[model samples]
Target: MSAGDISLVAGTAGAEVVAVAYRSTTHGEVHATVNGGHFALWFPGDELRDGATEGVQLEATFRDGSTATAVLTLT
Candidate 1:
């Protein structure tokens, strides 16, 4: 089993982020979001790779109108 968390800082207003998303190389993508200054995301066993691994990618957009990404790997 694997688990992890991500923290983001929303520097200004209109700062929004997609905190977590799930997808497979074969399938498409699943979208999730969080508002405000910070968020925590978790991925359970089998969610990352059909019981092989667990991980999450977090996407963020700043109020300055810039975008960024952070990745967390769990084991």
Candidate 2:
């Protein structure tokens, strides 16, 4: 598997990325985190690993209980 970092800029600073996961139909959550909002989680090459790739969905839950979602890609 290709190990890499998945960097995310939480629009709301200090919200604390409570969770970084990949979820999809017939699949479950793979966790990651944030350290100072950069170089956080190492993307676990597998789509269902601790990270995701193109077309996979990324769901981020914040400390405030709010959440955000995005498709995994490098573009």
Candidate 3:
């Protein structure tokens, strides 16, 4: 496994970003916030490689109670 990063634009004309989450059964969970623009999340490759050989899920929640999901895989 290797360290990874993901960037996303998580807001709209009316709805805005409420929270962002990175979840992994092996790496645990991380939560963050964005100030209406693009946001990026990074995970340590060394630490993640110890156990994370599976897919990790990323979620973005909006102020409108809407959510988006993305999956990333580490080989």
Return the top candidate by lDDT.
3
**Candidate numbers, best TM-score first, in rank order:** 2, 3, 1
What's the distance in Å from true for residue 48, model 3? 6.5
Tens-place lDDT digits, model 2, residues 1-75: 145633332222244776666553333454655556532333333334433343445677778888988765433
Write down the worst ten-residue block by lDDT for model 1. 5-14
Tell me how far the alpha carbon of residue 35 in candidate 2 is from the true structure, in angstroms, after superposition.
Answer: 1.5
Tens-digit lDDT track of model 1 for 14-67: 335434444534345544445564444333333454222434454555555666
- By lDDT rank, best first, the candidates go 3, 2, 1
* lDDT of the candidates, in the order given: 0.43, 0.50, 0.56
Off by over 4 Å in 2: 1-16, 24-27, 39-53
| Clashes (N, CA, C under 3 Å) per candidate | 1, 0, 1
lDDT per residue (tens digit) for residues 1-75 in model 3: 344543322333223767777774445776655655555555544444422455556687888888988654544
**TM-scores, all models, native as reference:** 0.37, 0.48, 0.47
lDDT of 2: 0.50
Tell me how far the alpha carbon of residue 52 in candidate 2 is from the true structure, in angstroms, after superposition.
Answer: 10
